[model samples]
Target: MMDTWLTNGKDEGADGGSPTVFIVDDDCSVRTALDCLLRSVGVRVRSFGSPDEFLKSKIPDEVPGCIVLDVRFPGQSGFHLQNEINRMEFPIPIVFLTGYADTRMTVKAMKAGAIDFLNKPFREEDMLDAIAQAINCHRARLSTAKNVKRVRARYDLLTPREREVFAYVATGMLNKQIAEELDISEYTVKIHRKNAMEKMEAANIVDLIRQATTLGLAVHAAQPEGMANGTANGASNRDKPSSAVSNGTEYDCTFE
Candidate 1:
């Protein structure tokens, strides 16, 4: 039996998105004071009296945001809620607030991936700083996710054989070795590898490996001998320069 309150307003951050600060505390007065303070700074906020009520809210997946959580509640502790959120793989950063602070609890909160843990009656500047840091962290995470998605979309444009070749190449396999493994000629392997590189817009083996790692693809420890010897289809170690976009920036593969 908890109440939920949402304060809506517009305040663009450096990234052009109005980030939200979610406040979950059992105390009504604490929630009100926080709401007023945050709104004064033009920050959007949503307050909940319990974790369950907060979880039931329809938070957008792409929103850059953070959570301010209290340490204790009637049924579930903040630590328990943190664990649940981690299990659910939600990307929002968390800042913990507590009246009873101890060394063990602080260590536990930090180890659990909390952005900050502040004792009750903390300084306003400290709270604001923690919230800003958390929002920045969340935004960075969202940007990375978007970049990964774009890379994955480019990967989807490759042919099936090219994808298989990409996997082998990313794992440090040479052209001849990939040919033998796939029961294809070395020339065919080379062609597919080139196609994959072009489609993925990978600058070199290093860049390809980075994208593959981001995609959670398994890679080998050894480097590709062909790339090391500069025999990768006579392609240079450096990536080829790309054409300019309408914005006058080079069309690099990096989403950042």
Candidate 2:
């Protein structure tokens, strides 16, 4: 029989706002040891003697984290836990630690998207590296999710015409130039621009430019040729921030 080393930490779980690493193993000594080792590095950990116990945990909806799982347990095995993770679509990345030197098991875990599989009697450095990788992956996943939500919110708020105006405005088009290009009156252009700006929570053109740029929208000069239309000699309007527009207001930006 292979001895599985599983560990959990004293650091608070996701509720404490730190990233969580759930450890599942049958040995109490192993659990305590892992918990100590993990906590030493500032990672939050939750330990369970069996996979069943971990399943009952109330992980937060917004929390991002990983699981330090064992390959075998007394009750439902580590592979079963992996399957449950799949079925529930748990977002936490998993790293498996096992004493059993089974290539088949390693392949299966990797194919199932496990971040790592460390053989038992592993070096402290190896364990630390695996946990670090899992946490980084979790952070990125959360960021992407947040961006997606923000983008969806922005998209839902915009009207079709407003979106078109937003694109043109982002390209550094002035209201008058946009009006001429769209074959609409300057007054109509102003109305659309104001609505778009308000909806985007952009106080001025600079805020709009930054937000649009973040979303990968292009910023073009309003005039086809370089420089302001009525500028003297060689001076360009782009050289300075315009006094006409105030660069205030926070953008409710999101990826589209």
Candidate 3:
């Protein structure tokens, strides 16, 4: 498994939690310069000389930011490092900095799902733009993750009956149908559904479905008449986010 590297601290220059920027370059000058530049723009930054060192450090659990990784490193190539990061399910998005750009390399990086690639001697504004976009994406991702975590926590609080109701509700079952399935009254199913929605902090059915799925509620797709027949749909739900909590700051969890 590829080792995941994460930034191990709170965001710097946080005004209502501004995004962070991590720079991993073998060249000390590049690191320093980028750090200064990022900091000057109200972005917190951490610099590292090598990928291994970055992997060794601790990163905050969640932050709005992205990693600026050099394509060439002292030991591990950036390409391999990126692949490993993906394998580990790290949360951070990456912006690659390459000294040499080629169609093949660009294709490879894009195919591996890099956010952006910057050639050396590129304009500062371009880097800043990419960084800003990355941080915003990271922030959104963290926000979603927080909500997901909360959803799961609430799901765990439900009684086994409530959990059963939740699954039915997510699969578009009516309270009447769920009651029949579980040998309960429609009123009872409605009560349980309401309780589950309240605990999940969902405003409506759609919100409940979204939040429940995020919490791994194990909902199956509803069949044409499964609700009427009180039969399990049996088909697996295929739509769900990956296990990684990526936003911007690379928190590849594979290492863990």
Candidate 4:
């Protein structure tokens, strides 16, 4: 008996984005069938007969997509290829198709982050559902990555003193505490903190902390005793001139 599965289709082109489905199968018939099936439902399809050919193809980072990979291949197994792709940080979600339904292989693939696994002669609807899930997952990941890049860019605009202030603020430090730690005037600390918040487009200290954590900048929040003291001395000797501030008053930051 064939295992059957079904899932609702998402709104086609909902975000004005075209997502591709990549099929890497050794069997020509399987490739053709998958290509036809995906294309019929408005998905862009790319098929390759071997893992080598798929690796050679240039897939753009901006394209929201997923991979439909066969488990067993001639040169390199799908599992090995998946590991290599993950090591390279390609960010494409994978759906595995295999003729031999080995329990151990399925567990490994799923543990390694495969979006879905199916045996040979799987239901067409089930494959479509897996493809849809994979594409959505890929799109969500790309969105997060883009957001991180934007946040990082804003972070880069901060002056050295402002950056220090931001780290202190993210760690729940008050203006007075930050001033004492940095050995600066309370007024100066407030000025730097305000500037950093504006540049980061944080709504409040809580929001700022969230963004910092997302960008993996939270580690800087916990300043070492020696480093904090050193920075305090350095800050004392610095000129009092304020850094130039960007005129923007609002930033559109989305978090899920």
Q: How close is candidate 4 to the true structure, as a TM-score?
A: 0.77
Assess candidate 1 and give its lDDT.
0.74
Candidate 1 stretches with Cα past 4 Å from truth are 1-17, 157-160, 171-174, 203-206, 218-256
Greater lDDT among 3 and 4 belongs to 4
The superposed Cα distance between candidate 4 and the true structure at residue 254, in angstroms, equals: 20
Which lDDT tens digits does candidate 3 get at residues 173-248?
6778678879999999989988988887889888887775665554445555434433446554332323332232
Ranking by lDDT: 1, 4, 3, 2
Candidates' RMSD to native: 9.8, 10.4, 7.9, 9.0
Candidate 3 global lDDT: 0.69
The candidate, 1 or 2, that scores higher on lDDT is: 1
Better of 1 and 3 by lDDT: 1
Q: Judging by lDDT, tell me the better candidate of 1 and 4.
A: 1
Clashes (N, CA, C under 3 Å) per candidate: 0, 2, 18, 0
Q: Can you write out model 2's per-residue Cα lDDT over 126-179, one digit (the tens) per residue?
A: 877787777666656556555545644664588877776777787766788778
* Residue 191 C-alpha lDDT in model 3: 92
How far off is residue 111 in model 3, in Å? 2.2
CA lDDT, every prediction?
A: 0.74, 0.68, 0.69, 0.73
Ranking by TM-score: 4, 1, 3, 2
The best candidate in terms of TM-score: 4
